[model samples]
Target: MIVIVDYGAGNLTSVQRAVSYLGYESLITNEPEKIVNAERIIFPGVGAAGSAMEEMKARGIDDALEKAFKSGIPMLGICVGCQIIMDGSEENDAVCLGLIKGTARAFPSGMKEENGILLKVPHMGWNGLNVVQPHPLFNGVGKEDEFYFVHSYFPEPLDRNNVFGVTEYGVEFVSAVGLKNLFATQFHLEKSGKPGLLILKNFCIWEP
Candidate 1:
């Protein structure tokens, strides 16, 4: 069973629905034992980074997640959920889980103006991803494959090789990251249509 963490995240239902569509059983819950004991964990979130971290901490989920992740379970994070897997975020002054050594910060303000693309904040739309590592998370997809996105900020890891896939806005940046058992994406595979499902399906079927 795949456990989708629910701490008042807006996109939880859509994610759960998509998972069900793929024929896998899933649960959306904040219960620590259920999450820690699941076959896999999907950390999906939306909204302010600091507030989300506070919610995780308040529920003692922060500790539960750390325990679960360290136990070698397959784990994936989406959007701000991805950010938390890293060190922390420049957004909302939040101290993240730091499982992946990096920081999530805002896109450069002037890049769009200088690059000739009238970019929008929050980058809410379908975007193309460039595969850097041929992994199961991006199984059945290619560098040209596009996925759904809904965030303005992106992850900037100190080690660039940790990036498994990338997406472009005014400039290209890491779209998804894979390091050991921890997989994360700045784009929402749950909302990316067919290509997205392929990715999630791969995750669902991945072995621990």
Candidate 2:
């Protein structure tokens, strides 16, 4: 069964609904055993990194996820879920899952557009990805397709090769990352409409 992990972060229901809409059944649970046994896992969240990590640890979900990853199960992360998979996050000065060798960084202050308009933090809107490398999660996804984003911090992998896609919001930032069995996106595929659904569908059937 596909498992949507719940570690007390928000946005669980929406991710569940998106999977259901794609004709795949999923369970939302905080149970680490369920997560470790899940055929596929979706770790999606919207909240502060510190509390999210705290909850996961308190429930032992953190160790379970690490075990699942090592078992070679296909896994996907979204938003804060994507962020905390890195080594650490500037969001709450919190150490993260370290699933990927990277850190999440806040968008620099005083970011501006070419037209001199100051860009907003929490970059809440639509943006297209400049896909740097092809991966199954992006099968059939194209250059023109835009995804929904809502974040102030972005993942920066220590190894540039881990970066799958990028998006510009004053500065270019890593928007998608992949390493072996794990893949994640900074944008919320659940909220990105058809294009987003396409990625979710791809993940549901992806082998790696």
In candidate 2, which residue pairs get closer than 3 Å at backbone N, Cα or C atoms, i.e. clash?
Answer: none
Scored by TM-score, the top model is 2
How does each model score on TM-score? 0.95, 0.99
- The candidate scoring highest on lDDT is 2
TM-score of 1: 0.95
Give the poorly placed runs of model 1, Cα more than 4 Å off.
113-117
lDDT of candidate 1 over 90-140, digit per residue (tens): 888689888888998887775674658677787888878888778877768
For candidate 2, give the lDDT.
0.95
Which residue pairs collide in model 1, if any?
none
* Candidate 2 Cα deviation (angstroms), residue 133: 0.4
lDDT of candidate 2 at residue 92, scale 0 to 100:
88
Which 10-residue window in model 2 sums to the lowest lDDT? Answer: 7-16
Report the C-alpha displacement of residue 79, candidate 1, in angstroms: 1.0
Cα lDDT tens digits, model 2, 1-208, are: 8999999888989999999999999999999999999999999998889999999999999999999999999999999988999999998899999999989999999999999999999899999999999999999998899999999999999999999999999999999998999999999999999999999999999997
Off by over 4 Å in 2: none
